[model samples]
Target: MSFAEQARPIERRTLYDELVERVRGLVVEGALQPGEKIPERELCERFGVSRTPLREALKVLASDGLVQLTPNRGATVARLTVEDLEDVFPVMGALEALAGELACHNITDEQIAEIQDVHRKMVACYEARMLPEYFQLNQRIHELILEAAGNRTLSAQYSSLAQRIRRARFMANASDARWKQAVSEHEEIISALESRNGEALASILKLHLNNKFHSVRKWLISQENGTRKG
Candidate 1:
């Protein structure tokens, strides 16, 4: 079959999903920074799609807490505060800890191996000074861990929450020093899991998330100081 003949026609449903993911990635990667307004016409041209699909994608992103749509001012990347983390992280920690405990009983050897592979790749990215790529792998590792937990509803909820949280973290740090410690922390998590130490894994993961909250707190203070000076 010729390439074009074999290629399936782009489905409207698939187009919307891809558009949402692409636009969400822009915000998550800081390509569209928080509080930055999106130029709709520009985006339509850039994506080579119509305004209808683009608008649909924007609506999805807004629903995901990545963008805020104003009555008249169109859409902009959502600005997150440290207070946001204060409200969200604890619940997320509890859920993830719950997931880890369940995962201990549900995980298969193949899943464990996949997790290990992601960790190894993350370590390599860290060594290569590729913070962005490293963090992406880090996310995959956590997701794999959650999948191993085998709780469908909890996994879906966590993924939604995490999408919002990841956008904030990416905006705040982009490439911060604490990323190094984060890599080492994942090492501990993998080690604990390998030993089937569920309790220890839960504790470590909780502490890891708590530390993130602390870091966000410190960053907020710094931002406040900068604002006062300016």
Candidate 2:
């Protein structure tokens, strides 16, 4: 290898970053369920890490609103209450609308084509009943729009909120009707971008996020009630 190539920074990930990602995966995949106490010793054993890094990772997760850490009770996965969802969705909707508006003004033909490719792939995933893959691609489509918007501040804020609410993707698995409805929304989103209709895209994006919030909130309420009854 050339000296110049070897000298370049490769963006190394710290042990804490790795641990945080692993724990996040556990929660998102339902291995660490909401409101369930995180077994610190068991997680350390599974990941082959020490207590220090595990605790550090948990702290990060808590800040992201994924894990709730208490003084005496330790950490449990956070339950998404109706109030929390209501609080977040409006912020997300407004950011998404702004992104859509700016994306239409700034997006290049190549960028649009790239997003379209992901859109097609996402549709295929939906057709195959691959919820996880579809969810990831759907997120990628939104990410590309945010990136194309070319506003660093908007992108950063939108992305931080996006990460905090990433688990809401799982709620789409609750019903085929809602899943299909979301796919339909994505269809309009792609069309809006294609036509460079900024206002149309902004409105569509806001409505889509609103619908998603409602769907997830409904499912969470049902689960909460079921737990109460049992």
Candidate 3:
């Protein structure tokens, strides 16, 4: 009721959000690796804030399962296992499938045109041998599909999940061949969407995700085997 009280609550919320973004960005950018401890003084100085806001942000990240907080050791980045991937990726695939189905139902002509343009740009990136550029376009196309799904909650949830897997999702595979395969998969997904076939689009999306999962798994296994042999 009082202006002071009202202003305090708003300020608290804003600081909380700012801190959350700071910590999340560090994790996403790999400035903080999984299971690595966050330096308290460094964060305090970098953010130009006090311990209160920094701790609040870490708590929020811990709540998101993005970090683990201990009594004495403080917070460390969350480490994901292959089993974690098995649990998380399928849920992501289902959410994507749901988005694709909804996109088919609610997509506007203008949105379709935008996605088409992105697809064309994506192909151009592939042809130019600019895989990083192509991957960015690929990400934009998927985000567009989720936005066109017209469900705010779904979009937010999917985005959060994607953020959790950002590192693994962006890791390079064995060769450029994998990049080419990814481009081909994106083309099929766009074609299915353009034709307004929800079922086909969903299937393509699932396969696209599975391919990434398999590729990552193979790479991880090879690394482990190499360590064993060494």
Candidate 4:
């Protein structure tokens, strides 16, 4: 057989994988609220998939802690408790601090410019009160920093924990005060990165993550209190 003939087209993602991402987005974006039942029928109709693939996707989400599978009750979005943040954020802070330090050593001027551009856009989103867009850009900046760090192991570990708490992180911006404070922190982050001050960047990153934990914790406590009142 000719080498050309032996070559294959790039494989597309499987339907099951696509369903998993779509369903996970629902959970992350709050379309499927925490503790709310996963409406299998509605989703099946919307995605035009059978129960088999959807259930498989739900299983993936459950493993990610984004959903809970019950015996007879089916799946529901998992709630983010203060305890979850308390456990996760400190580790995330340490990881982010390390990433910031390494990024200061390794990142190129062009990479810093790329992050600055995104940071400007994120600031604009904040000014406009576009929480979702701001969050996406905010996430992109951190991802770029991780990429700049050039550590696959750190990236993999951080990403795993990141996926588990994305919804809670998004909710951290629910307060205008916290959001402004976060933006101020981002400014300091960029300045430190631009200066290539590894220690300063590390300190700022740890403090940033710590503040985010406080914001998310406050929001979760408020939510629990509201639930109790209702």
Candidate 5:
């Protein structure tokens, strides 16, 4: 066999993996709300894929806590409750704090500059009240920190848990005051990173995550109460 023929190009992504990401985005971006039935037929038509791959994608989502599967009832979007936040936030907070500390030590000046650029854009999004764009940039900032931490295991673990709460975390900015406070917190985070102050960054990250948990917790409670009243 010729060398060129033997060294065939690798497929970057599988159909199943692509389907999983597309479906995950639908759930994360709130196109598929929590507890809503997974409309298999509609999605299959929309994506021009068959049930087999779609269902397989959903199974991956279920494992990630973004979808729930049942024997008779099929699948539904997994609802993130206050209880769920209570369970996950502390762990996430610790992970984020650790990431902040490690990133301060490990991140290069160029990487820090990159994050600052993204942060500036995020602030502009906040000023414009562009929630969707702000949320995307906000997530990117945290992801960059995780990448700088240089721990594959930590990144994998944090990412898995983050997927479960991405939508709820995005909605935590519903309160204008809380949104302002979060931006202020991000300012502090940038300052600490710029200074390479690991301790300060860790504390700020923990505080930031704690505040977000409270914001989300309050929103979830109000939503549940409103449902009951309705």
Candidate 6:
């Protein structure tokens, strides 16, 4: 093969993935919404894609619990129930604890600074009351820690669990007090990582996640009850 041919940029994203993202974005933005039927035809028209790829994406989303598929009723965005949080939280706590432990030993000073930089920006967002931006930075800080943990298997598993709970995380019911408390906890996370205290980081991360689960659970319960009423 020619060098030019070999050097050409590969199309890494599949049509199915692009379609899945389009649908996922709609769900996260509250457009598709929990329990609302996925408008497959409208989506196809919007994306200018055929039903084959769109249906394939729907199946993928169903497996991820972002959407549900019914025999005759078709697809709707999945609701994250309190029960769902109950099942997922313990698993997430374990993964987060594991990541925290690993990261303290493996994280470099430069990497630590990078995470701190994002944390600083996150605090700014919180101060500015820019929730959407704060959520983005919050996810980035967590991702950096997972990366620093240096375990592909742990990162992959943690990432999967993270994806499953992202809707709740993004919609977390953070009262002003809760937001302040979260930022304070993040300060300890940084301190532990900087001091290379693996056990301390693990406990902090696990406990922090435990607190986070309750906040999200409150929101999920309300959402579920609201949906029922509507």
lDDT of 3 by residue, 84-119 (tens): 778888998999999999999898889999999999
Please write out the lDDT profile of model 5 over residues 137-157, one tens digit for every residue: 999999999999999999988
Cα deviation of 25 in candidate 1 (Å)? Answer: 1.5
When 2 and 3 are scored with TM-score, the better candidate is 3
* Alpha-carbon local distance difference test for all models: 0.82, 0.88, 0.84, 0.90, 0.91, 0.87
Candidate achieving the largest lDDT: 5
TM-score of each: 0.81, 0.87, 0.87, 0.85, 0.89, 0.89
Q: List the residue pairs that clash in candidate 2.
A: none
Clashes of 1: 0
Task: Give the distance in Å from residue 74's predicted Cα in candidate 6 to where it truly belongs.
Answer: 1.4
On a 0 to 100 scale, what is the lDDT of residue 110 in model 6? 97
Model 1 agreement with the true structure over 101-218: per-residue lDDT tens digits: 8888888888899999999999999899886787689888889989999999989788877877785555455234677777778999998888878898898899888887777667
The order of the candidates by TM-score, greatest first, is 5, 6, 3, 2, 4, 1
For residues 69-88, write the lDDT of model 2, one tens digit per residue.
Answer: 99988999987777887888
Ranking the candidates on lDDT from highest down gives 5, 4, 2, 6, 3, 1
Question: lDDT by residue for model 4 over 115-214, one digit each (tens)?
Answer: 9999999999999999889999999999999999999999988987887788777765666887898999999999999999999999999998888888
The predicted structure with the larger TM-score, 3 or 4, is 3
Q: What is the lDDT of candidate 3?
A: 0.84
Better of 1 and 6 by lDDT: 6
TM-score of 1: 0.81
The lDDT, on a scale of 0 to 1, for candidate 6 is 0.87
**Ten-residue segment with the worst summed lDDT in candidate 1?**
167-176
Estimate the lDDT of model 2. Answer: 0.88
